[model samples]
Target chain A: MSLDKSVVNVSFLEVKVWRGKDDGELVSYQVPGRENQTVLDVVSEIQRSHEPSLAYRYACRVGVCGSCAMTVNGMPKWTCRTHVKKVMDDGVLTIEPLRNLPRIKDLVCDLSPFIDTWQQAGAPFCGTKTRHEAPANIDPESKARKAADAGLQCINCAVCYSACDVVSWNKDYIGPAGLNRAWTLVNDARHGERQSTFDKAFGSGGCGSCHSQGNCTRHCPIGLSPSESIAGLKKSALFGLPKV
Target chain B: MERSLFLTQRLTAMALGPLVLVHLGLILFAVKGGLTAEEILLRTQGSVGWALFYGAFVVMASIHGPIGLRNVLREWTDLTTGLINFVTAGFGFLLLFVGIRAVLAVTQTATQISG
Candidate 1:
């Protein structure tokens, strides 16, 4: 007897995917399960075979791009790296867009508000040197450089923003990710607008607004601690206060 | 105002941490010893140590409570930040006045007991 070797044996996985805009509902779909399937893979399978209209964002499937962040089960996670076997409960998965941001469509949240907060926090780097001047050689062993390195891994994933309770409550809050960026700039010796950055950081809806709830640090995929960064900003605010 | 208030809150919190433990420890000691109010007052009467201890507690609480309330009001209500600051600043002053007066009243009564 000849065995049917061409057929692939696949088990089905139950997946609950969020559908529609902000007012949308979760739609359940049965997807073919494979070994080492990631949450992103499950999403792709569902999008490829069952529903072609499902919308999600991702790049660098190896987890470096940091764009595939979504709420898995109840926590924000980098979908590309979150394996289905690890997060699935009773062989079921719940996938939704990141929280605390406006959902643009199915599994997609508009990141404008999150990105705009960077500007509000004065996170832009301003350098004083012209092309004619030699480059500023910053010592890696310097205290400020070490401080900047502590929070320099953020990829604008918005996971910290979604995780922050302050962001949800205060519409004006700069949020963790933004303030964390400003913190790096504050410690950079090459940054020209240190005072202005400190001004914005110490301003209303800035670092002072963070209650140190630690949600940002807790949810960051890169393990950067924004809570500590905010605490540092709170301490630095004393220097900025005399001007106010 | 936000920056100053944040700094004050942190400063007061640091002060309160130790003060609260001392206050609690004193209360526990008094309770365990079954000391009555009169007995406790007698112990505190004309004691500069007790006066300074309670004085710091009242001052720290006055600063800490209002700043905490400011954060709560901002989170729980739609009140503008300016209005919230105005109210919380007023509350802070009220707390300081009331707290200091209470401290003074207790200390004065203790002084009378000694005199």
Candidate 2:
């Protein structure tokens, strides 16, 4: 026999993607695939070629926007950042909407709770500067700025919330992304609302409840580690504060 | 209940942090050095320090594992009642017994080791 052998070039996918209106049925999808294809690519292919009825959301194809995050193969992930070969072994893929939220329709989980929880996490940047005044200068190398920068890249994907086991169990718990956001705001030097943000994220179903299981870090497609951020928060709560 | 649990978990974790790391480091060093069991016992025999260290490790582990398992059962499994506590307590006692026996053997002098 010759030492050289030919390789197979085929595009086939068997995706068990959830389908229907709210409170709907699970449906299977079989679509064409290619090497280096993403889960979002598959959904888009299905929408464009096979079934025009599929619904999903995405603003940027890259991981930067965090808009195209979805549950791929049982883990919440940014679909845009995920490759088919990495997740879809055995030619099988199961696509589901993000968990711990209302499902608006097939493949689209409602993001209203995520936003609401962001507020619950106290993530808004509140400064005294008015619209007419010159912008206050913030030092990039400052400790506060670096701490804030640690969590500022989050795109509000809800991937952390969906990937969080704590959020699923304790519904009151503001998930990792929200807590991570709160941490950044807490670290903002311009923000006078630091104490309030701390108060919001420190109690029951809060930063203390995290078991440091690191599921959020494991699943984050953007490489932001919310577990570290949460740990930082816990440290502040426990030891860094001056005695009251 | 919350305060006690948090305190206990923290205390155990604090104790375990160094103990587990030291334990792992010792296992690695011993196995890599190809040290025999007799050589290992030679150092440990009649050593109160080793007994205390191992005793603290076992006690901390007994406190840590059941609390962790308790949370897991509460979250993942539906088993709850006095029975869960009874089982957890029983497990802790078993760990204490086995752990103490190992510590005692290591603490015994050379004559006691062979005896």
Candidate 3:
């Protein structure tokens, strides 16, 4: 789409993009405002036209890939999906790396910690059925299946992880994303290591650490409620375990 | 330990919810409804019902208060889990001892009233 000269001549967005590693300065970029512009478009323009050295991550240029999440005006958002007009505050936008993770570079935080927490939560599914066994037919309408289905679509974007205050306060907290993934696995009847997964979830850095502040649910791009999932985990942990 | 603490915190909170409402409602009634200390104690003194009600409240609060404080201390301070747990357990015991003593004093007032 062509930019309107009238709109470009009138005003430009005062974009403050974070530059360099953690503790780096915010570099300002002046990009002409256009109708129906996305935050990603501004970043791309800054990289393509102005600052080639500016580093950020994105793929598919849509919401599906989950690679383009960043802190937009103090809120963690999927930058590719965030419309510039909608999020503009006082005609300015402050873009930075996701919170609660170590910043790697400009608009890029290292996701290793977030990914490791997922594994720590024991989220990966291990089926009990052997190769010789026929496929276990799961009724989608079943209560357990439905409960699992609510949290199954997580893309591991770490938005919930970034949004979690508990994670921010406690580095060891398994976080919403990890707990949400674990909640899915817990509801799966075919999961081989259910007891172990429960053990991991109830460990020191597990779901017990979450304060149920609901920031993870509020900022989730895909509308998944990790808060609810974590609550479920807490309940399951309470019911599954023998009386203390 | 973490999981058990989490469970106990939640359980205590559930117990505290109704207890708190009753406590607050009693306070409001006492303050606004113009009931004097004697009038209030007349019903409460030697009453097993009041003893049980406040006993449960005290029990739940002792557990809940320390756990909540332990979390806040963990987040805001540099204290380790072991140290915090040790300190908070002492605090819970202190609350329990004092609270039970106060409850016993009020309940034992029946002898004084009769004498």
Q: 2 or 3, which is superior by DockQ?
A: 3
What TM-score is obtained for chain B in each of the predicted models?
0.85, 0.86, 0.88
Query: What value of lDDT does candidate 3 attain over all alpha carbons?
Result: 0.86
Model 1 segments more than 4 A misplaced: A1-7, A238-244, B31-33, B44-49, B109-115
lDDT of 2 by residue, A1-244 (tens): 6632221456568988788766677677777677678889888987887778888989889877777888888889889978888998588898888988888778887898888878887888899789999887888888777877988788888888898888888676778988898788877767878888877777445676787889998887778899988887877754442211
How accurate locally, in lDDT, is each candidate? 0.86, 0.79, 0.86
Deviation of model 3 at A177, angstroms: 0.6
**TM-score, structure 2 vs. true:** 0.66
lDDT of 2 at B10: 74
Task: Give the runs in model 2 whose Cα sits over 4 Å from its true position.
Answer: A1-9, A21-25, A131-134, A240-244, B1-115
In the range A188-243, model 3's lDDT, one tens digit per residue, is 88887777777888887788888889999999988999898888888875678321
Quality class of the docking in candidate 1, CAPRI style: medium
Worst 10 residues of 1 chain A by lDDT: A235-244
DockQ, structure candidate 3: 0.56
lDDT of 1 by residue, A1-244 (tens): 7863432587788899999997889999998777788899999988998999999999899878889999999889999988898888898899999998998999899999999899998999999899999998988888778888899978888999988888888988999999998888889878889888888887778887787899999989889999988887887865652111
Best by DockQ: 1
